[model samples]
Target: MTRQFTGCLLSRQWRDVAGGVAIDLWFATAEEPLCAHVTGEQSVFFLSADQWPQAEVLLAGERGFTSSEPGLRDFSRRPVRALYFPAHRQAREAARRLLEAGLEPLEADLNPADRYLMERFITGAATLEGTVERAGGHLVMRSPRLRPADYRPALRIASIDIETAMAGLELYSIAVHGTGPGGAEERRVFLRGPGTGQAEVQAFPTDREVLTAFLTWLAAFDPDVITGWNVINFDLRFLQRLADRLGVPLKLGRDGRPPHWRPLDDDGERHALQVTGRLVIDGPEWLRAAFYRFESFALDNVAKELLGEGKLLHGPERGEEIGRLFREDRERLVDYNLRDCELVSWILEKTGLIQFCLARSNLTGLAADRSGGSVAAFDFLYLPRLHRRGFVAPVAASTAPDAPGGFVLDSRPGLYRHVLVLDFKSLYPSIIRTFNIDPLGLVLAADPALPEGASVPGFRGVRFAREGHLLPDLIERLWAQRDAAKAADDAPLSQAIKIIMNAFYGVLGSPGCRFFDPRLATSITLRGHEILNRTRDRIEAAGHTVIYGDTDSVFVWIEEAEDDPAAEAVGRELERTLNAWWRETLAAEFSVESRLELEFETHYRRFLMPTVRGSEKGSKKRYAGLVADDNGDDRLVFKGLENVRSDWTRLARQVQEELYGRIFRDEPWQDWLRAEVAAVRAGERDDQLVYRKRLRRRLDDYQRNVPPHVQAARLAV
Candidate 1:
């Protein structure tokens, strides 16, 4: 009996069946997890109809059928026919064959699951219908017709941590901090041996028993999202090895399926994991994608930064301490393990990273667990609209030469007061909107019949149609949505929107994107260059000395600085004048409404624009400033200087901070410098003298002699 159910897509997989491809889509409904099986759907790709004679000869025995009639057309406007295969594997094999035979195959790179849902416009939330049955406490349906549905379900999450030997092969303990149905919090630590701790510790006699018990607990909790710090590369990988040693399955997935692991590279330094019915997101990766920054991504450091607390054992001997606790102090070990787990959970909640992930997925139609797919996100939002505008998606390739980047003006190095910084708000997006710069618009404007004044002229022989463009309108909508998100104080949604909007330029520039043309990227960036230069000119023409400019900001140095309020008034006036100038200028010149907005970003009382080392020429992208805090206390801020560099020693940073602060504040520093030198000579700065440098290349790869870190690694080895 056919039935219908509504839910959000949780996971998807596919396999070859007897008759056709079998697609398994798991959904998270309000009641329970539902498994929908859409069968009898063949994998498909498009080919030009003229190539059918050669294709049939090449794919004679393939388990598929070629359409008798043409269905679609390639970007070149050649009529294309569809080829349906019994399974995804056959379709991929046929595509490879066709490629080897030098025939163009369209839409062959799309995943079957993605193709199916995108064709139906069923992103994330959808309704599934047909042949319903009850299976394993969840509803199961077969051959379901999916329709778009607005299903947003609350997801259960678990933060997992594991303690292991220094070699990272032996399992010491596994701890889970989970929130399940009804928001009930669950905490458990499966220690390998008999122990006692403040945490809820379940002791087992052997590693195998502990592993089995942990798996059981995980199944019982059944979290939709499993997260940890470097969980896949370390903890989960070790657990899987342990399970294999004990001849047991690592059944962490909801449907009794084991976690699948694939090495991200041939070196096996990193790996990615996929759970059958859950999203296993690495906390640090997700946080970085959300633009979170810290001194280090180490759990202890992150926890300390975000939650004002570190691990139970935080010190130089942390690794040795863990082993010692495991031997003599089991309770401490359990506490440490459980604290790590809970810290991950706390960090996730504090940052609202999960919400950001969901918002990103909702906005881009990508899975929540996917990372750094700016190009894919652009395609998901752009391709369908392009097709609707009577254009097929082009193949991924760079069609034009490289383009110049944003304009960075040479700085006038000096220390000055009342320096105001003016910035263009979302400069590239605004330029795109103002100029109607788009791939389709570029094509339309290039028509021979298009009159000279019919389209807006751009840099490098590019012209954009006045109408029938999509990106400008698309970005306008996103811009408004971002404003709404900001108004609602939805940081996650706001950030997601901002990221997506910013990715448009990058997507157009990337050769991996199907829409990539140097013209499209060049238009945006060159337009930016022009705008920044013209704005700087206008500011200079307005009787202000523009000391520095970079990409989208201009630093105006006001002479004989008054007070902070006077400086702020000057900035506001400058901003208003520049905006008015842009509005009138664009209206007069291009006959276009200007979206250019210059915002008053910062007022640095004592700003320093340093020159290049050992040269009189000024630097670009490096500066320092002093600003007053809310309590009227002066704070020294550094950019691209030793004070902010990670590789610099603590002693160097401290000395710079002290020297710069004293100089900026007009305080005497000779006595202080002498005292610091004496302390250094007396070995009082021993701890601060150690240099922490990142080895960006492998030890063996550094054939051009060795750096300090490489030498240290050699000495350690």
Candidate 2:
């Protein structure tokens, strides 16, 4: 039987055998390989179908398993989801695809003999996933009508996370949250590990009574939802194992409830963490929704980015800090754990993730724990409503994408050119407001343009199209009231409206949301692309240059009629007056119902959008905007906060800024590159070069190809 998993691939440990490699995959559950045989020579990777090359793949066995694969690993030892690619050749291709997906690809180039042995099991692509008859003596093939993301989930949500000792020996804490902004307090409970009772906040005398007191408290807070970060793989497993060893019931959560806590059977056997409850919401899995590309989602790093505050404890001795919190200082631990709870709450609020979770639940008919796709969500919501005297949701028409290689344009700095860049802030939300696009309404009314709070039209057999679809009615009312609030200038009401509007888009786009309809999303984005392009053309036709645009922002270059100051002033004034005319003209012409704000962003006297160092893609979102003063002096700034990013050491920013600053100001450069290189080699300003890079994950994963920071982490560990 074929097994499937969603996970990250780690390093390959090569043994003395000719073709054997110990591959590690970080899986979401504790699963063994689909086939029991573990080949010595194998390639490993994470589970994602998008990265796999379906064409080059000769065997289904070798193609990386997406979640849709036939079998699932049991939820227990949730390590890297292990997959064995017997030979290195197939693994190499899989590795390349993984690299494209933004993972650090690992390859083990073993001897050729192992490569040959691994090829025996290679199974290529299926002959046809879907077939169509050919009228002209040819057969066309396609995959199944993939409602690419149709999984909507039920909203009985539980946000769970775990805290454990660094030694991986003891469970220090376990917290489960509810669907509300607060984790658990709303309708859930948090269970403290044995260490919680001795917390410094209350200053209990002995460690022995602390664990018992915490358990007693747990007996009171009975819960259905169990949550945590890798709680199944680590936290709950350790706690249950410890309880078994001590011959005690793992009386966990509120009300000292007794649900059998099993002991660890053997190596690779499923453990306590795998025990299922009503639902378990992994904080990390949910966090993946945000798409924040940062190294390691450590508690400290995540807290700082989302909450603006982290645990007061700092330094290389975090393990020691954990010990101190439990042993020497219970108060600090309470503060720390409570702060983590708050951060989780803040993240949920910022993303409206729980709302999506609930929305997904309502759409997919799946429980909260099941991750659903957009197509699944849409189908779930649309089909039942259709069945009650209804119709099927239109399956996405598979077609070629718009060809790449669209030309990128640039706007160079001209003499005193007063360029007015017009921007549409939150265009999608506005479009939703004007168009009456509500996902809930689509589910209920299924109408192209439903009015605000309009009763969903009654279905042939179903009722309440009259009352309105739940989500759409909710959104329509929210949008209408938001508009009212905005008009009335009620700050709090306006905020609520904005929240609901933003949440609509996220729900439409989110895979876990029930209304994850691509049509809903496409309707918004395609319109946006059209608006941006049309706006540019409108400006250009009016005798002004629309130099560049990205999404909602448009950059313009005011034609400099002359080089001298007197002539430049005349040109700038003309540019500003023309901008006002364009704004009014767009409003009068199209009933698109949108507003644009023009800002005089920069006075770049000289600029360069150099092609990316390795590729011909003219480096976009990377450029210099500079201006010169009367005394042959200049100052420069980078477009993308290039100066502050920690990876961009002091070297590049200073050199680029100085070079442009002088060039823009009519200052002649003589041998500038030489001086800059010498300065760097001499270590004249080395402190500026000392970069503190963040380690994104645990240090063990980097055992093979060690980055400088990874090496630093190893030393620290």
Candidate 3:
């Protein structure tokens, strides 16, 4: 019987069956987990029809291989044919043979499971209709027909943290804290000990017992997401090693399968972890993916910053402290272990990072736990649309020409009053939409059959087809959805859309993406350059002095405005006038509707465009300003300055903030500066003189031009 169900995709993988490969897509619904077992699908790649004769001759004797005309053309506009094989390995072998014969196989590098989902245009949420049967604690759907759906699953999350011996060779305890289905709270700690008196703490005789008990508890809880601070690289990795040593299988997957670990680099220093039906989301990784920055990504630091609470123990001596607690204070160790788990849970909850990850997955068709996959995300969103448009992208180029970046005008160094900032909203994306910049559009515009007036000019002798583009329409839809999300106060969805939209330019410019083309990237950036220059000219023509401009924002000195309201009125007027001018100008010049939006972003009562440290020339990105807060109190803002940089000393940041604040307010700063110098001379602020920096390489690796941090590290060594 065919039954329908809606669920959110959690994980997907493919395995070799008897005669072919079968894709397993795990999903989480409101009531239970389900695995969609899809088979009878051929692994395929495309080749130019011109090369099809040679490819067919090369693979003539191969069994389970077939070829067909898919009616698709490559980016070069050459017709392409599809080569299908029964399994991925055979397809890979065939592509290797073609490559060895000096022929190109397009898109053969894509994972089979990813290709399956991307071809179907199914991202995260999906509705499945197929024959279903109950397996062990879950359902398995055979050959499910999947379609995209508007569903978001409320995932059961478990945040786990483990305690280890000082040598990191022995596991001391494991703590888990999270909510199960229906929001029921659960907390438990498995301790390897001879003594225990704390509630929710289960004591076992040995490390193997503790590990086994924790795995059993995890299976019973059945969490859809498993998260922790540095979980994959530290805790999970350590547990995997311990389990191997103890001759016990670490079964953390919902399907009673062991976690799969793969080294990310040649050195094996980092690993990627995947479970059958769960996402292993490391807290710091997801936080950075969401653009959250902190001076330190340590659990204690993040917890304190986000939750106003931290671990019971901190600092460099934490390892020794944990050992002592394990030996003498087992109960305290339990508390500490559980506290760390709870802190990770609270931090993720406070930041809404899980929701943000899910939102990104739903938008880009990437996995919910995947991070830093801008190229893959672009492929996930673009390839399906391209295929539907009767085209296929070539493989990523081995090399791509450099593309220009955003425009940054030289600054006019000065301390001025009533400076207003005007910015282009989503400048790159707006450029893409207004100018019809796209990979397929660029290809189509060069066709001899294309009408001259049906294309618009781009940089570097390239043109884009006006009505044959896909990216502009995609961005327009995302823009509208973002607006709706903002109206509904859906911050996660809004942020996800913004990140994806902004990443388009970079993806096109990146040599790692299959659609990489310098012409497409330069078209957007150079267009931005043109827009900023024209905007600056217009602002200056409107009787305001253009102070500084960077990328998408322009700072104007409204000297004639007497107060904040007057300056704001000028800004609003200029915004409206400039936006209207752009609309009319683009329509007249290029015959395209302008999506360019000039927004009045901020009005600083006092603003400063600083000069270079050792030169009279003004700096481009360095600036400071004083603005009014919501309560009408003055607030200081800094950019590209010591006060906002983590590598600078605390003393430098403190003095810079104080000096800038006093100067902006027109207060007596000379005396304050003298007092601060005197205090520094007297060693009153010695603690603030210390600099904190993270080393990116080994100490011995810095043989030339060693930085201060490297010098300090060598000394410590």
* Overall lDDT per candidate, in order of appearance: 0.84, 0.45, 0.91
Q: Please write out the lDDT profile of model 1 over residues 146-256, one tens digit for every residue.
A: 888755566888999999888846788999999765778998999987768454888888998898898888888778889998988888888888888889999987789
Backbone N/Cα/C clashes per model? 0, 65, 0
Write the number of the candidate with greater TM-score, choosing between 1 and 3.
Answer: 3
Model 2 RMSD in Å is: 19.2
Local error of candidate 3 at residue 570 (angstroms): 0.3
User: Which numbered prediction scores highest in TM-score against the true structure?
Assistant: 3
Tell me how far the alpha carbon of residue 84 in candidate 2 is from the true structure, in angstroms, after superposition. Answer: 41
What is the Å distance of residue 501 in model 2 from its true position?
7.2
**Over 4 Å off, model 2:** 1-164, 171-212, 218-297, 301-309, 324-389, 393-419, 424-531, 559-611, 614-618, 623-717
Candidate 3: tens digits of C-alpha lDDT, residues 418-485 = 99999999999999999999998999999999998999999999999998699999999999999999
- Best-to-worst order by TM-score is 3, 1, 2
Question: After superposition, which runs of candidate 1 have C-alpha atoms over 4 Å from their true positions?
Answer: 1-8, 48-53, 68-73, 124-132, 141-154, 181-183, 197-199, 398-400, 449-454, 630-633, 696-701
lDDT of 2 at 323: 74
Scored by Cα lDDT, where does model 2 land? Answer: 0.45
RMSD of 3: 1.3
State model 3's lDDT: 0.91
Per-residue lDDT for 622-660 in model 2, tens only? 655555566756556566645645567666666666766
